[model samples]
Target: MSRTFDDTRRWVRFGTDLMLRSVGGLDDDAFAASSALPGWSRAHVAAHVAANAEALSNLVHWAATGEPTPMYASPERRAADIEQGRALPSGELTAWLRRSADALEAGMTALGEERWSARVVTAQGRTVPATEIPWLRSREVCVHAVDLATGATLADLPPDFLTALCDDAVAKRATAPGPALTLRAPTAVWELPGDGEPAVVTGELHDIAAYLTGRPAAPLTVDGAPAPALGAWL
Candidate 1:
């Protein structure tokens, strides 16, 4: 099934809600604990997700007002913001997360059909229309919720979103140099890098998405062999 912007928005809302729930009621010690993401504390992941919401909101503002707003002044500045936010008191960090998400949601709701076509640039330096914003935000919240390590897993994500994520991951790998592999999911098959007698990998849709995105893929098998290391994505 094709996904519409409305579907993207719903997923964003759902994902953010899940993220909030996962991190809720954390104490400073809990926030300081290491997250599933290597070398990143729970606080670091929370801060990054919060800052991401605001950065994306800036893009929505640019779309609605025709101002040339970039997601960040520079890569260094983005890193600095996340680092500073990570040091916030536990309460403040939680507040920032909620506030930024609320602001982004408001910005998205304010955008009309015409504004949806407004051009914007992603932090990765890709130029895309405003319609891409929801997908970007959805990816962030859903995936990072697992990074929080508060018991959320990729399986907790919406099925349709997982399917879309798998497709996107395959498309991204197709453009980069990588070992040729065919991914088999319950509902779809995608050949990564090229179409050939590639190594066949099989797993649940979300597990495949996780593996392709550089997350754990213990459940995935490559041609009945050990899983191959994936190239960098994002």
Candidate 2:
């Protein structure tokens, strides 16, 4: 099925809710349980997503108000801010995430399709129409949510979302080297490792997403550079 950006946003909201639901059943200790990713607790991941939503909401507000805002106007300042907030209690983190999502939702809903096309600048100095914020926001939450071990794989995400992100990650390897990711597919022999047996990335698109994001060993082969790239992406 085809999807407009708004459609992507709706699905993103649903996916975030899914991740949140998984965490809801867990206690404080479990919330802080170590997931597959090193240096991040489940609560830390949750707080990061929630805090990001709040940050994105602020940009949306700036756009609505006709004030100056860049994609991440304070790119350098953001890391410190999120790190500080991620240390908050689990209860507070959950509340903050929900609040951030609600605030962004209200702002985006009020703007509707009409303003999505309106031009706005991001902290990185790129100017894009406001309509794409949800795409950005979705990328942050949906992907990071998996890191929390909430049990939802990227396979659970919408198909288009999965493919686009994977392809994007692959293509990015050429120019950005965002992470060393190996894509194991049916037709060709794809191996990122220069050495070692090829571990193929197995399963559906979402599984590829989760495995790529550092969750579990994708039923794929790993030999060389891609293995290190995994850590970079994580």
Task: Please provide TM-scores, in order, for all candidate models, with all chains considered together.
Answer: 0.96, 0.75
**Residues forming the 10-long window of minimal summed lDDT in candidate 1:** 218-227
**For residues 1-234, could you state the per-residue lDDT of candidate 2 as single tens digits?**
133686667766876787677667666788778864688888777766876777677678766877765434465667766676667777777777788788888888887556667787655566777876877777777677667776866666766676656654554344433433356544222334334443444455665655555556545434322333354442
Question: lDDT of each structure?
Answer: 0.89, 0.64
What's the lDDT for candidate 1? 0.89
| Superposed Cα RMSD, model 2 | 4.6
The CA lDDT at 22 in model 1 is 85
Q: The CA-based lDDT of model 2 is what?
A: 0.64
Specify the poorest-scoring 10-residue window by lDDT in model 2.
186-195
- Give residue 167's lDDT in candidate 1 (0 to 100): 78
Number of colliding residue pairs in model 2:
22
| Local lDDT at 180 for model 2 | 37
